[model samples]
Target: MLRKGLILAAFGLAFVAGPAFASAGPKEPRQASWSFEGPFGKFDQAQVQRGYKVYREVCAACHSMSLLSFRNLGQKSGPFYDDKYPNPNDNPYVKSIAKDYQVNDIDSETGDVVQRTATSADTFPSPFANEAAARASNGGALPPDLSVMIKARPQGAQYVYSILTGYQAPPAGLEVPPNQYYNPYMPGDVSAFYKGKGHVPVGGFIAMAPPLEADKVTFDDGTKSTLDQQAKDVVAFLAWASEPKQTERKQFGVAAMIYLLIFAGLLWVSYRRIWRNVAH
Candidate 1:
């Protein structure tokens, strides 16, 4: 009888503790629609442009995309590509964009560092002078580079979209630490901060507060700037920045597949014609 009672107590304890651990992980990321989902799908150029606007106006304040150059924005199938300009550096739009920002350079004649207007050939400059400066400005959290961020995280595009749009009031009985905001999409264990015996919490703490606001940026194309729209567009841009050649790669793959199929068919036909008379 005592053995049975002890067994029952163990099961009861497991049942009680299970709920707490169950909600310890972040909620599954919300699915977001993207234009470039399937192999043949292409990026929406307009959407990508809008996404750049979001990054320039908001994300650029912290994150740096050092991998990209203004010239890349005017390359073939790029965001601001103009067919007339095969050389991206010569593209007027790219030049204009580069002119808006300043880059550090040393004067050829004098050895002093000087800030000069960026050119299409120059890579992006870091927002902070150094890593330590970056950390100090952002409350000890170094803002990550946005370049290729989509590839770095699992379900990255959707993850970004959810985080931007998923901020909500923290659940009751959960104590969020100072300088942190709760986000259901962020991965973390919340049981320690959760006071309830029922379920711990469904999300983790994030250092970044909600970055998107309605009408935060006025779109040049006149798309209504909702919170959801901003999130979707910026995610799209990051996805593109992660792999600008994705569309071209997909196109090449399709063409290669077609060519291979035709070659295989011709080979089969040749084999039948050559061996038909000798076959039993």
Candidate 2:
């Protein structure tokens, strides 16, 4: 307990220094329903799977989740988790997913760079080889990595959902520039676009165009593909990816609390017995 508390304290201190501390999205993220919200709440595996599908089909082309590997998809409570496969590396589903990706590797015998089929152990490869290339590909705007993005933002999940779904036509006379788009949820000062003395519009300029659309990616579960649905699903996957161990951590916390309660009760009973025969 002390160790966990210390770690949490250290984390809190670090967070105070983190960029997220000063986060200032133009508008508060629209709240959304989530399965993993409370202490005993758990992830909906089916929903996570659908979210992963959305990420793979749409987001993967531009964004990278390099902090995660294909094998993580098979970890306990993960999108492809299977009870029969105790180790994620052995999960057939994860293997199939990894096999589909072509990763850059060195040929051991020839000592040459080569494109090889990926394995479950490999991390998700970036779409671009370097930051410069990534920025160049997207009109000098680099796509941020999705790993830990949920933890890095305030109201993490809601913020991402709003950004994904909150795109709209630029407010009148905003004078949006080439390669830039306006989103009400994007964080930035748009006062420059407010020459007419209004509230500067409740948003900022973004390089990213609207990514999700209705029917963009078909869900295997036959769930209707609405713009809202796609945004929610992908956000869920990002939520899970942000902390793969969150469910396990919550479970451990519950067990620890229960144990502490039992121990405290026993100590109280012992103290009462010891003092019963003594005078005040």
Candidate 3:
């Protein structure tokens, strides 16, 4: 996220300091650039499932993406397209999980309030009343709803992957000035929240330390336990989290592919017929 402000405003505007503070440290895991694409090596279905387990077991208590529905776990929707799509009903891994009641807000004459409903629908509930309230509740650190996080963050997959795996220290001789916030991915003190409390002044910085650890969530099959591996899994999960429309997109993609192939064949035949007479 980027921030704008006057020359002297410093950290008053949250945006300027938001990213810098958010990225105060390189606490995430390390990942390869290719993980952003589909069929990412080591970033497979199992890894995503494991990452989800980590979220549910460890992080969910503090952070909640109420907007996400259990049904979404079985679907695939994101920037990248892969053959392994989520199937809520058929997949044994997810089918056994019980669905729960979902709640939503209805704007009625009585004003804004929450109402519980079925969870089978595609909608989600907001975790907080608004941005300000959310930030206040979470120690001045708004735990962003993960439902659309993969989409909201620019180059979200890569960013999330980097964040997950970026917990290392800065290279030799790199010193964080007393006033400036420190981060690996963020370029400088540009974080808006330089003061005791404020938003991230830097554009690409965030303060929430990396949550996942190496081999934290081991799968049934033995796999190497490394931060990079964890990063791959978490990023895949986030990519799926961001887009729950994978099945629909894949269906459309197959149809488009067929149409293009048929069109190409027709063009080939037309060209042969048109040139046949000239050859004779």
Candidate 4:
């Protein structure tokens, strides 16, 4: 009888505590120190191009984005959504720019353009392509698809920005505590994003391997940009990448809020009259 009572009490306590823990919204994602609000403020073509280079050169070895089309790079979905390339039938930029810009890999034997075309049958090409290959390349961390990453995780854009710039060394005498991850800016054990397996592919607060480095890539104006800047641009790119319809959503959300506020005011006025003299 005593055991039963104890079990019931334990269950009750668990039930009571569950919500408090669950509702504690995860740590704030790293926000790039940009001087603006909303996703549109961070859009920059140069930044996106640099970020694409970073992803291709360093982070692409492990992650695969099966969903994104190669043409998505310069399509209406890109940062410059105002104008699309003329021929969807043929990739003009790819053929023309190959001599100057080696943005993608060209197959030596078959002459295939790397990272081209989004097809139903083919999984998105990995920044690396295979699991063993990526792990061997990334020191055991597997980077995952960035395509839907902004939408998949909580506070996705902020998180992406945070993780990209989250690298830091732990204090001299303190070994990292168990189950607690390290993030330069974020506190606790959140790895960036995980690949399919129980692996900490990349992301969370303290990922083991670092994908982006400060000043590794530069802008056209001869300024060496920091990793934080690159990360911010990429986050903005990804945010836009996922939601081309973000402007519409915001407009609708504002309209909805206004409608609800008006409705609530009307309800209050109606309730006041309905119970005017009935208050005891």
lDDT of 1 at 139: 78
- Please give the lDDT score for candidate 3: 0.56
| TM-score for each of the candidates | 0.93, 0.89, 0.58, 0.55
Task: Give the alpha carbon lDDT tens digit for every residue of 158-249 in model 3.
Answer: 67766665545433334434423345554444333344444333223445655677677665557775767666665667666766565456
Expressed as tens digits, the lDDT of each residue in 1-280 for candidate 2 is 9999999999998776543233334888899999988898778898899999999999998999999989999999899999999999999999999999989999899999899999999999999989999999999999999999999999999999999999999877677878999898999876655544334577788998899999998998999999999988888889999999989999999999999999999999999999999999
Compare candidates 2 and 4 on TM-score and give the better one.
2
Give Cα distance to truth, residue 24, candidate 4, Å.
12
lDDT of each: 0.89, 0.89, 0.56, 0.56
Model 1, C-alpha of 78: deviation from truth (Å): 1.8
- The root-mean-square deviation over C-alpha atoms between each candidate and the true structure, in angstroms, is 2.0, 12.4, 10.2, 10.9
lDDT of 1 by residue, 137-186 (tens): 88788889988999998899988888889999899988999888999889
Off by over 4 Å in 4: 1-27, 33-42, 80-91, 94-124, 176-181, 184-205, 221-223, 244-280
Error of 4 at 137 (Å): 3.5
Distance (Å) between predicted and true CA of 93, model 3? 6.2
Q: Name the candidate, 3 or 4, with the larger TM-score value.
A: 3
lDDT of 4 by residue, 1-280 (tens): 9999999999999877554333222345655454224633434555555556665555555566556544555544343333545442245543332223323557789999764433322333555546777767655656567778889877777777877676665433334544345554444432322212232222224434556677766655565777776677666666655664555566677789999999999999999999999966
Model 4, global lDDT: 0.56
